[model samples]
Target: MTAPAPETEPTPPPGRRERKKQATREALLDAAFRLFASKGYEATTVEEIAEAVDVSTRTFFRYFASKEDVALTSQEEQFYAVLDAFRRRPPEESALTAMRHAGTLLIEALEVDGLADERMSRFDCLMRLTEESPALRAGSMERTRRKNDEMTRAIAERMGADPERDLRPRMFAAMASTAFMVAADAYRMGVCGFGSFSEAVDAAFEVLEKGFAEY
Candidate 1:
């Protein structure tokens, strides 16, 4: 089911005004991460993020509801893309195989977008914030569980299983989700025996997949 990455072209901006708004939004996202990285996520206030971008706190709220919201915005973008990628996987593949490929696309996309590097990435800041802040980590855990459930539905559809009656899809989805997270963390800690995060994730899935047969 795993195919090459999709190459969809981006649409041109509709007009100058919309482009300007988008620029502002992008600037805010970048500025927020920079501030969160430099000043500490808890210490960095919304006002600081707004002021860093030469905008009012009111304008900041216009773009993002809260600090946590801005912190998660980039992740939200990638999460949806992974879901879409899951739908593109070949149907003949088992749910676990399909998920192994689609799920790793999360890391693949990050690498392609030039955000997977430990250095020289705003996402690094976001990751650090999520790791350091108890509140952010709690929110992230709940968010991950919800997103995993969404993947569970996709897995059920691919496998032609009744989600209401079948528990296998959900279990497979949960395993894939945990595997990806563990792999990414291992890569971050330089213990995954891989150069790339995507490879780390693949290795994690491979090792995890071998477990049930042993027992």
Candidate 2:
């Protein structure tokens, strides 16, 4: 008797469609960044970005709610990644030490991923855009505020303090964030040059460890 015919492989269902959507979303982000850097964020229209990525205006909206969202997507992930690292610090470490370690790890990862240059480039564009556009400025502030909240919770957890009752965690996190931003700004402005982003972060943490009393 002839063997029964082998069943044909089943086709993938709707989940494959979701992955395609994600790829399209990332492509849109890449296209948007390129346009914003070259043409200026304010002058770059949604239609232009959609066209650059070979998608319709309606399709762009399906991925990003607005142009501002494009500037913020990767930054949000970076902030959360750092906060998560801080939250896992050893109990023996001081809050400041924990933050320094977390920051170092984050910088290392950025460098490893070859995102340091890209991040600086995007940040430069974002700074310029925010300075010129009130709407973009508001979006930037909102992103910072959200990151601050996440850092506060991470600090509180690391210190074994109640996030609701203790103000120290929030204060420390705010100060740490401020220090990091100042260092980042210095690097961007060419005030300090280092071999790698991690080196810059290490130098900044050293300065912080030395205390701002000298400043």
Candidate 3:
């Protein structure tokens, strides 16, 4: 007997809504960064960015709550990705070891498609804006605090640390994050000067590896 004809799978509907949302978000981010770099963060208005992006002011609110949110909002996904990796590290791995691995993965992920350079440039601009505007600085600090909390929790979980009993993982996470940030910041500064950005990052990591006792 002949087998019954196979059924064809249904195709998914076109992702028009999702694609449009992504395009709109990118447009907003691009416009905001341009305006912030050229006009300075404090001088740039939400309406101005919305106008530049050809979006309504209400649409801007749909994506970000305020001007400061624009900068911090973009990093939310990256921050969580790293945190999730950290939390899922093997229980036997030392906090420092896990952090080193996670940091390397995070850096590698950022290096795709000449994104490292683009990200560094944007980061430097954001740093300058943060320094120039008190509101931006405060917003940046809050974002950093949130990231640190997430990292600490991830490290604690990986090390099987009890919230009330162990502090080492928390400390390790803090130090590791500081080292990574210092490396990135130094790279940014070096790039602004005459040094190679990648070389500066390597040097910073080398110093971190040598430990503070050798300093």
Query: Clashing residue pairs, candidate 3?
Result: none
Worst 10 residues of 3 by lDDT: 1-10
Total clashing pairs for each candidate = 0, 0, 0
Question: Against the true structure, whose TM-score is highest?
Answer: 2
Best by lDDT: 1
Query: In terms of lDDT, which candidate is stronger, 1 or 3?
Result: 1
- Per-residue alpha-carbon lDDT of candidate 2 for residues 53-108, written as tens digits (9 for 90 to 100): 89899999988888888877766766777776666666677888777777777777
User: What stretches of model 3 exceed 4 Å from their correct place?
Assistant: 1-16, 191-215
As for candidate 2, its clashing pairs are none
lDDT per residue (tens digit) for residues 34-74 in model 3: 99999999899999999998889999999889988887676
Using lDDT as the measure, what is the rank order of every candidate, best first? 1, 2, 3
What is the C-alpha local distance difference test score of each model?
A: 0.78, 0.77, 0.71
